[model samples]
Target: MKDILSVKARLGLGFGSLFLLVLIISAISIFSLSDANNRFFRYVDGIGKRKELSSELLLAAQQRAVSARNLVLINSSTVRVDEKNIVNNAHRKVGELLRELTASVEAMSPGEERVEAQRLISDIQQIESLYGPVALNIVDLALNGDKDAAVVKINNDCEPLLRKLVEVVTKFIALEEQTSAANVMHSQDEYELQRNQLIAFCLVAAIIALALTLVITRGLDRALGTEPSILSGIAQRIASGDIRAIDEIKTARPGSVLASFGQMQASLSALISEVHNSSNVISGSAQELSAATEQTRMGVSQQRLEIDQVATAIHEMAATVMEVAHNSESAANAAATADQQAQTGGVTAKQAVAQIEHLATEVSNTSQAMLRLKQESEHIEGVLNVIKSVADQTNLLALNAAIEAARAGEAGRGFAVVADEVRNLARHTQGATQEIETLIASLRNISEDAVERMEVCRGLTDKAVLQISDTDVSVTAITTMISNIQEMVRQIATAGEEQSAVAEEISRSVTRVRDISDQSAASSEHTAASSMSLAKLGGTLKQQLERFQI
Candidate 1:
């Protein structure tokens, strides 16, 4: 029975027993109802019908006796014939009733009941036969006019026979009534027996159904192992994330449903542990990257500040070079005007010398011209000294610019090249100024010699004029050198402007780099904070998962 662990088998066995019990109850009820029906029908058909026939026979016998008495008393022929006919009709009807009663007894009655019925029927028959002859004789006597005698015979013989026949029929009717009552009692006894049997069968079926239900229920309990309450409690604990409950779960039977849940808990624990470890490693790597980014940002900021200072120095140098270039341009224009004046002075000196040679009689005029030439020489020397002073000032400015460029390092490399070119131009200008000073001294000496010779001898005037021509040529060459020095200064100014612009661009690039580095540092800080948060979350998750014992 325990081996029948399948649910379908248990249910089928339980219901099959109930169905058989119902079938048995139905069969018993049907049989009891059928037996009762047969008994009721027998009472109506056998005993009841026989009693009714016996009553009819008694009535017919009484009717025939009355007709015979009337036949004997009647005197008129017409009245006598009617009476006789009535007696014959009653006689025939009585014989018919007797025959029907005998048939009823033979067909329906048995044993003592049948014998009693037959005997009563025979007595009726005998009464009917004797009454018939006596009736005929009474009729004959009446026809012969012996009415009193017929009446007396009828009273003495036929009356007693008729009374006896009535008694027998009444007794037979009573016996049929008793037989009907007995049959009814017997039917009730049989019905009681059937009812008791049905009750007994129902009790047996109820006991069997109860026993089968217990067997099936016990089998089901053994197969399931735990009750619904225990299963529900386990499920609730799992839903709440209390995986330790898996250890507490003890199965009463092997191969239970809880084994699958235990496997799931184990798998989940392993996966969560791996996730926690990976999160920790990622957090550490992120923090290291953030620190490196911060250091890079600081280095870029310092570079930006140095670029700014270099740009400022280059701007100042450009301005100073531009001022020097404007001064050099003005000096070049002065030199060109002076050169044209010197050429005019040379022509005038030759004219004066030629006039002196041609007019020896104009000695007083030549003496006054010599004194004017000596004064002009002194003025030219003063102008040369001023030019020399300007050259020295420009040289000093160029030297200062070169020193500043050198201090600016790599950022001012182009400016330094331009400064070196300006310093060379200034040195050339200073050398040219020294040459002009020497030429001016020589020209003054020549003018003095020519003036002294003119005073001493009028024939030396031609030699003095030739010496002044050579001094005029040397002054013109000095003026060209000053113009070349001015052009060089202008070129230096242009290069300085270019260097300044390049420095400005470098400054802008450095500022942009600084901004980008700052932004990177901020981003790295944000990443570090996020990594720390992730580490904390992983720790929390690991702690939460530790509650599970799987």
Candidate 2:
């Protein structure tokens, strides 16, 4: 039973050891790849989850901010209505609504919205501060606590201020919505892409592991059968104190009983012929196995060399990724700066537009004044016409008096000359007044035309100012969007740099595995080919062994 166990153990151990080695190598490969895949999946999931959360938070914050701004606009309009009517009902409604808005905003998480929302809130608070004091004053005046003049002052002062607040709040709402939408879209896209990539990587890795297990098992079975024949021959020769002539044994086919018998006979013949020298063929087979091992070692060395090269490449890739990340961060910062500058520019443009509007208004007033002057000139011209009419009448009266003097003959001669001179003087006065009236009419027409031209210019200036205001708003919105995009890009770049660095490390690792795998594959192919050659040689030896009488 021990002897049977020994024989079975020898055969089983040899086969099992080789099989186990193959399984161990395959397991190592599979495990390493599985670990890498798991890590990648986890990383992707973690990043994606964070991005999704950020997007959700950002959207919520943006919505809250928009809602707050809208409420502010509503509040402003309410205040305006209150001012216009000087009513208790409007005031109470506005106050109630304002309180509700504040409560709603406070209910929402302030931290989620961050500084932009806070800034918008601050703007609203500032407006409220101004409005609150003015509202109280208006209320006091409306209740007859102050003079009617104070109520008029409140109406006059508060309307324009409230209108300005309304405009600002409306703008803030628009900006918040725009940024929020973009951020949400980008984050969703990135998360989906990461999920897909991880899935693909995992699927591919699983397929490769199954293939490696099959090939290794086949090699072990063939090697096991050959071990017993060689061992039996060596054992017999050693026991008999003979030199083993085991050349045919070295060349025998695996699992051939005839070859095993021939190898046993040859060892017995060697024991009888010579005392203690084994055949050189065992050394040759050992040399062949050593050569195969050396080839595998060379393959491993080559694998290591390739791995080093890959590691270098990965290092370079990592560096490049890091640079890209840095550039993205810089770009984001630059965009933020640009956004700030654009906001400033928008403000400047708004001021310029306001100045232009003011200039246009001043021009309109100047044109109106010119028109008034022209009307005054026309009035003067009318007076001059009246004076001309009176002068003409005086000339006619003088002519009639001259005619009367002529009727009195030589006694009226002196009077006639005087009357003629008086008529002439009146005629000259009338002509001069007529000329002055004509000049004044011409001047009045020119002034009217100038006023009309100035009005046209003022209209054009108003249109231009309005256009500039719209453009300023558009530029501000674009700048804000760009700034948000830049910030997102910076975050993406940072993630990309980290991913690239990880990819580089993974690539290096993969390359090392690939190189080792390639070398192992190469050696395995060579080994398979050599095993075939060995099998062929063993067949020849079996044929040769058949000729020997065992």
lDDT (0 to 1) per candidate: 0.71, 0.57
Q: lDDT per residue, candidate 1, 319-375, as tens digits?
A: 766775776677677677767767766776776676556556456555665676676
Against the hidden true structure, what lDDT does model 1 obtain? 0.71
lDDT of 2 by residue, 155-227 (tens): 5755655665565556545544554564456556755665676566556555554444454444333444456
Q: Number of the top candidate by TM-score?
A: 1
Which numbered prediction scores highest in lDDT against the true structure? 1
* TM-score (C-alpha) between model 1 and the true structure: 0.43
RMSD values, in order shown: 76.1, 29.0
